[model samples]
Target chain A: MKFKTFAMFVGPSVFLMLLFIAFPLVSVLLNSFQVTQPVFTTQEVETCSAGFLTQNCVTEVKTIPVLDENGDTVTTTEWVGFSSYANVLGGQRFVDAITSFDLGALLRIDFWRALRFTLTFTLITLPLVLGLGLAIAVVVNNATKAIKGPVIFVSLLPFIITPVIGGLSIRWLFYGDGIVTVWLEALFNTDLSIAANGWAIEFLMMFYRVWHVAPFAFVIFYAGLQTVNQDTLESAVIDGASRWERLRYVVIPHLMPLIVFITLIHLMDAYRAFEEVIAFSSESYRITLQYLTYDYLTPDDAGNRAISSASASAMLTMVGVVILLAAPLRRTWQEHRGR
Target chain B: MSDASLPRAMRQPLSLKLASNAFLLVWLLLAAFPLVWILAMSFKSPVDAFSSSAWEVLTGPRTLSDGNGVSIVDIVLGIALAWLAIKAATKLLMPMTVAEGTLHRIFNWAVVALGFGTLFVIGFFFFLPLVAAPLEGLLGPLGQPILGITTEHYQAVWVENAFYENFRNSLIVTVGVVTVSLTVGTLAGYGLARSGSTLAFWILIIALVFRALPHSVLVAGYLPVFINSAEILSPILGENAPTLYGQPLAVIAVLVSINQPFTIWMLRSFFQNIPVDLDESARVDGCTHFQAFRWVIMPVMWPGVITTGLFSFLLAYNDFLVTSLLLDASNQTMVPAIAGYFNRETTTTDQVEAVAAAVSITAPLFLLVMIFQRQIVSGLTAGAVKG
Candidate 1:
């Protein structure tokens, strides 16, 4: 009887999840494997190869074509399987576009540069956001009644403004002719074109992202901090522990679960960082995987499908790495909690 | 206890106090600087705003000549009024005369009025710009000279720019997406919550992993498949596929996919919060599983439904990337519409107009937040705390 009831309750969600979320993913997985077209013929290969490869050494390539509105002709084509993958890997496009376009060696250089940029952004912003959030939470937790309301309200204002508006505001603030840039230049006695350098762009993006996201972290941490056992802290104080010692020994350990939770969640959010980067920086600073995928998927691009799939696959691998690294920590936390 | 009689509670040294205060001051400045700068910039003209000397105004003494200076005026007036009221209350005792009583009553009413009035005025102006411009344009020659309070902006918004059409498209997309996602997600959440099976648990985890994939990446992948499917489905569906690409349906499909996991997560949490005893009682009373859920669980989860619905609604509304990618130029949402007006190589006037449009776009959202502030705050913080 209980089984029947539970089954009834679980049935609808299972069906919908399978239909909507799971189906598309399964389809993508299936499509990734299939050879969509016949391989390139020897005649065609010879015509294209010129002096690059030996004559009659035919490379089998599957072509995936994007059809136009009329569905008659192929608007664009991607040579799939090893050929496409080889193109991505071999710096062919980089060599071709280097003189005319500044698209650099995407596979070898751009990919790693973007990865490093994203990693640096995440590393700097994650700890800063966490630390700032925890500190704010501690202060708010300790604040007197008179000052609490205004402080909390002000602190929470960033949370209330949607990322779009907040990002735009940041963009306006740091744009070349804007106040922040001018002020920084004057103060530092040097030109600081925030948009010009990749590091500066990354830094600015991180600051905006942290500013927008920190309030959320602050509120969550504050809630978690409130649940911390006051007696534990008081006992630490009685035992002659300094404030830092008490925080380190009792509060930090207590906050570990929350820290992990927030970090994991924020890391996922950071990986998908798009709106702020798009709003704040030009396309040159497309230093994240998400931006790279977006660039590939832009309207006129021929490599939309393959590049998107490849980039998504890359992102999934990154997520897998994160999950692997965090799993042990998560298990330890869980065991500690259980104990 | 009196201030002198009360014991000092672990008094810190002056240096420590100073250091702490300095730290707090720096943080406060960091938090307040952007907002204060924007508030200041809003009053200044384009030239004055872009001037290098404007940064000095931040540190220097308050001056009206800095800008139109309404913000300063309001702040000063508020402080002075507060100070005066405090002085009057502390200095005086009984209401001896009609004048004193009237003054006190007026002051009391002023305070109350100011508190609510400020909120009201802010809301009014926010909405005013959005509506007034287009209305003034529609008013035509009679709307000549573009009065400071004119509805020219509203007219421009509506008739001149097809703002209403875009708004309609947005409305269709937002409503469709929210309704579809809510229906689908709520059912899914119920299933996940009720199912004791490990399969359900793993499926839930998979759903979350899918959700965690950056939206841009998903949308990037989604565009090709959707476009291809639309092509294939066109012969059968007929008129649907062509419309699907840049239409509200595209927005709805993308948003529903993006939002389903969050809805499931939130709804599952809400459903789990409800006691199992309610289900048992319902069952004992001869209600079937569906009936029990309908009568008992659904009502209890209404707040969750509303919260999730609002979130999905906001997500759909605030979204730009998917909307920009999927929708045609004519079918743009207000955010993208404003963004379009200020892309690379935009003119100064274009930037201002874009800002005006942006201000228009966000105004309604701000109003919605204010009206539903309680629900929003609770919904936002619900994930953090148990109760």
Candidate 2:
């Protein structure tokens, strides 16, 4: 209980967190303003040739920089202030598209496209995760033990698999000539590929999100179910409340705080949509900011990486995520202070 | 739909009950069918597994079974089997006194009859095709037919894909993560529980915030250090020092850091439930605080620690992005390996091996879940229920 004892107890965890998490956060911020590239040089040399060509002369060994002194093509990292951010913003092209009011052109910017998907993914999945999870929890709570164990196990399957694998499983079901897709086409007497259109792909992504995460909500709500005041439930039963009314009045209110906790976790997670996009192979019709950062880091044909751009986008993404999480975060902080 | 005849206290409508059951059954299928199908596909021949229709997987070269009709005798026997199985299972599973009156017996009989009919249809249609095909394949020369199953896919995936190596890497990283997170997190959680200082409370709140920070965001932070390890780590250990990138140890460290916050939150509450008197008594008897924790506290807290450890294992095991990005290609984890299965060998890929690889990846986790379902669920819901 003493300060020294507490420090001795807690120091290792804090040290790990700071070294791995806090330090990297600061490093990312610093790296966003700096750039790195492969070093290149231009030079000439002199050589002697055979008698057929009399003599072949080359320039002396005078190394030349790949770019002018002030340009960005240098091999070394440079502190370029917000230039990386501006470049990521697509400065001239984005500004022109915006001024001209071309919606298609506006979305053509990789950052904007990724941001759009990320925002939609986060906002839309929030309510569904809460609602569906609550529904499953309520239903499962009333189930017999024999049924309950298997049902819980089944529900946790999606949540237990790795995110990328979960997405891939869902994608495989509707992939090219996949069983469900072909069966649907045969039954309905029409051909429609879920992966062929943007909206359809988005739909699958959204559906996958709900399936993958609702179990998390269900588990939390199921725990919350155990904490509901039994005396209050008994009193409500004596008052002849219907099941639905009991749920609305007694259960929902009891689980409100847990709901908020789940919402906070979901928002932060959903905003960083990387795995699903990759698993779904949605790069053609869709992308998320997280994937966009990875895209920047991917080596180009010439083997150069866009690390500064990736860092800038990562910063922008953090800004958006923070903004999205701010309200729930503040509420939690206030509750802690009150406690 | 009218329900007044059911009794005044139990006025629930038949329609509502039917609809609820139907909806829940549909949801159960949605949750379970994918895993079952994947399991089936994993055992199928490559020809059937990759066929445009999943039906072909079971319909291999064999003729179909005769049309089976349900008769009075078959129904009666089915109901008998269902009743016996349920009765025996209940006797083994619980100590409750089962109803045995004439009326209760009649009701149980009716329920078992319904269950029997359902099980019979499912077994005849789904399980029959699944099992017979495999049986026929292995014993076709003895007047049997095609089983449509093969071990070749699993063999190819295991031997050719370097799956064993990646699987080993995953095991090492996940185990390391669980050990590290539990050690530090339990101590920190106990410190918070015992200290009850405002500082400790605020630290928990901060940990929750970090828990909300997206992992991909954290991966972004780690990239520069990992990629520039020699430059960054040289001064700390002085030249030719070990670096973080391409090391399973680095992945394990990051995973532990990511998972520690949740571990502390879960264990702190569990530790709080232990009476402070126990620790005080140990201290009064001339034991140090550390000794009190190790001796007095730990024995009572094994369940909570195991629960936290299971969750930490899940976090490390289920992760892909952090492992894939930080570890070298040769040292990748299973989940990422499965995700990249096609791309890594697009030219040489037999396609059937994908499902085989997927099955292998899920096999360990499947066993883990089967063994610790209760602990995993409890760990997940810890601390969230209370206000």
Candidate 3:
């Protein structure tokens, strides 16, 4: 292709990406370092009110946002450097908690609390998803041909359903005298409240994530299983390798790149764990970093949003993604160079 | 060895086979039960929907007392009609339209779906009651309630709550995002696939990074711009330029950009698989680059395009965050609207209605999976296997 044609073909996509993805990144960085506030002015006026038998007048002062000619609030933006970041990171309260060696206090700060859950959720689910996915793939691989299609179809329901809806379905199953809870209560002869406990909510959230994501992993791994080297497997069998040995050595090694691929995709996705927070309504007990940023952006009753802090939190999330991506990215770069 | 032939070492032992099948059954249940359970709950009354007893949820005895039971005739006719529709769609409608290619097939599908929906409405509401009322009086026991099922929650949702409006908005957003993303993505992907330039590779790597960034990060960046877009555009379009905030178009643009990276990566891999020699020969035969691409390349790119389009459709349709934040109440999409039912105070009736809404949204997805399961499976493996 000529450079002109290539440019023509790639131009619109590049433009949109740069405008939406690239520009927003730079803007987020800049905004994180600045604060915007509506300018306020204090005013006093005499007020008259009709009493039961007499009129009473009083002068009172109130602060109000100054409106411009267009009836929009007049706002000013000022550079605040890292103050917003500090605020989002808990500022002096974080320092106090750290200096006091208070683990509970450290976890009490919203940012740290969110970070802990986000990291734990991502890390814990990785192994479970991988293991369950691999197990399903292997079992399905061994199944009769007639059953494979239906099995795959059934497995895909969880992955293909909307994330929020999937979460909601699982929540309905386990929350407040839900069928599963009821069954468990009957079996154990004890009462159980899933929603009332933080640990249970966290467990359910992770369980939902694993349920939702493992099918995706299964699909990918199943695809990977098809291309596994039969000659290598036969050679291992000839060498008297047991079934587990054959899998541990021949099969898993073949699927390692795919495992990495799934891991990278899973990490990227699980880091932005926002829907589970809403679907499970775990705001009181648990929140993820993405939800923390969203919480900041959502306006309160006073119609005030923490835009700067939201930006800071968003930037921090992007940084976390980049860090998680570093190893896989470097491996890709090396492979590209080697090729 | 042939694929059907299993070597002794490769085959599962008897005990292993039983255990594996058992495990697979357990997993299959785990995977499919929630959707089945939810769909069942949607048709029952609130009491039955939330009942601690699984048997009550399944039977919906309270729903029967509430004058919402389905007669044997209704059940038999409903199932027969549904079976006939599926058979017609597969055996007749599919063959008739599939030969005309993608666009025609899609149009045909829409027509068929619309026809089916109309038939269903007429059968359930207008025709079934009219027939069943007299039949129930005549047959007595035979025409009595065999199951407790109701469409009342669906009525409350799609009619009373006007959930159809959100469904319409969702359709618009998904359609716009898919069309725009695929158009731009296919061109760029083809360009990148054909180009051996280092810049293309680097661009792809950057796109990978962009794809990894959490959606909230992008939304944070877009929020300020969208909120002030009227001001930004006023200089170019006069003082009355409209704000991009709360507009479906704004959501479409954001979703397209968010989806573009994955789109490009997937499409580029697909494009790379098509032998370049076909286009090369077209160029040799006095075709311009654009003509070669259009006449020679795109003709064969349909499968890849359709696969990529399915994924793009899924992303845009399944999205909750961008749509919720960018759109206002009147313009809200189905996912966010369903979430709204729980966000506020709600009665048991409202919760069941919300369940109906959730089930309603999943119906199209179910249809999509049934029809496009092969395409979806291939699409999932396309990126991972190639990359």
Computed on C-alphas against the true complex, the DockQ of each candidate is 0.28, 0.45, 0.77
- Candidate 3: deviation at residue B96, Å? 2.1
Query: Please, what are the lDDT tens digits per residue for candidate 3 over residues B296-324?
Result: 99888999999999999989889998998
* lDDT per residue as tens, model 1, B150-232: 22334555688777777787788888988888887877777777776656666666666666766654554455566677667
- Candidate topping lDDT: 3
What lDDT is obtained when candidate 2 is compared to the true structure? Answer: 0.77
What part of the reference interface contacts, as a 0 to 1 fraction, does candidate 1 reproduce? 0.29
lDDT of 3 at B305: 95
- The deviation in Å at residue A293 for candidate 2 is 2.1
**Model 2: share of real contacts kept:** 0.53
Using DockQ, rank the candidates from best to worst: 3, 2, 1
- Model 1 global lDDT (CA atoms, 0 to 1): 0.63
In order of lDDT, best first, we have 3, 2, 1
Runs in model 2 deviating more than 4 A are A45-75, A230-241, A301-303, A336-339, B1-11, B62-143, B344-349
Candidate 1 vs candidate 2: the TM-score winner is: 2
Model 1 residue B185 distance off true place after TM-score fit, in angstroms: 2.7
Tens digits of per-residue lDDT, candidate 3, A154-204, equal 888888899899999998899878899999999999999998999999999
